[model samples]
Target: MDNCLFCKIARGEIPSRKVFEDEDVFAFHDINPARPLHILVIPKRHITSLATIADTDTLVLGRILAVANQLASENGSPDGFRVIINTGRIGQQEVQHLHAHIVGGPEPVGPMLKRV
Candidate 1:
C-alpha cells in the first residue's frame, strides 16, 4: 500500500483537509465533494476494499461508522447524514482503499439513488 493514495493521506505523506484522526482511523473532507458536507473516513492501515476485509478489520470498520455522526455534525450536517461505502468496480469505487463517505448538509441530499 506504499503507493496507495489513502495510505499516503493517513501517513501524512499527502495533505488533506483532515476532519478527525485517532490511533486507527483518519477522516478528512473530500477534495471533490458530492454534497455540501462530504468527508471520507478511512483506516490508518490499508485495506484494499470492503470486499477484501477480514475479521480483524471489523474493529476499524466499525470505528469509521461510529464516528460518522460526530464528523457530520461537527463539520456541517448536524441533523443527519448518509454513510456510503462503495466496494469494487461494480460499486463504482474510485479508490482501492476501504473508506466510507459521509455526505449531507443543511438540506436533504435528495433520493438515495434514481429508481432503476
Candidate 2:
C-alpha cells in the first residue's frame, strides 16, 4: 500500500484539497473534475477495492456514503449528488485504494465513459 495514491492522500503524506476527514475516512477534491463539483471519499485504512471488502467492512462502507452525503449537502448541491465506486480495472479505478467519487452541481453531469 506504500505506492497507493489514495493511501498517501489519506495519510497526509501527499497534499490534497481536503474537504473532510475523521478517524474513519478522508474526503477531498478530485484533481480532475468530472462535474462542477467532484470529490473523492476514501477510508483512512487501505482497502484495495470494492471486491476486496469483507462483511465486517459494512459499517465503514456506510460511513463513507454518509460522509459523502454530508459533503454534498454542505458543499452546495442540496438537491442531488452522485456517488461512484470504481471496483477494478474495467471500472476505471486508477488508484488501487477503495474510494468513492462524490459529484454534483448546477451543471449537467455526463455519462460514465471508458478511458480511451
TM agreement with the true structure for every prediction: 0.97, 0.91
Task: Assess each prediction's global lDDT (C-alpha) against the native.
Answer: 0.94, 0.90
State residue 54's C-alpha deviation in candidate 2, in Å.
0.5
Best by lDDT: 1
Write down the RMSD of all candidates, one decimal each: 0.7, 2.6
Off by over 4 Å in 2: 110-116
Model 1, range 45-98, lDDT digits (tens) per residue?
A: 999998999999989988999899889989889999999999999999999999
Name the weakest run of 10 consecutive residues (lDDT summed) in model 1.
67-76
In model 1, the runs with Cα more than 4 Å from the true position are none
Q: Worst lDDT window (10 residues) for model 2? A: 106-115
- Distance from true position, residue 51, model 2, in Å? 0.4
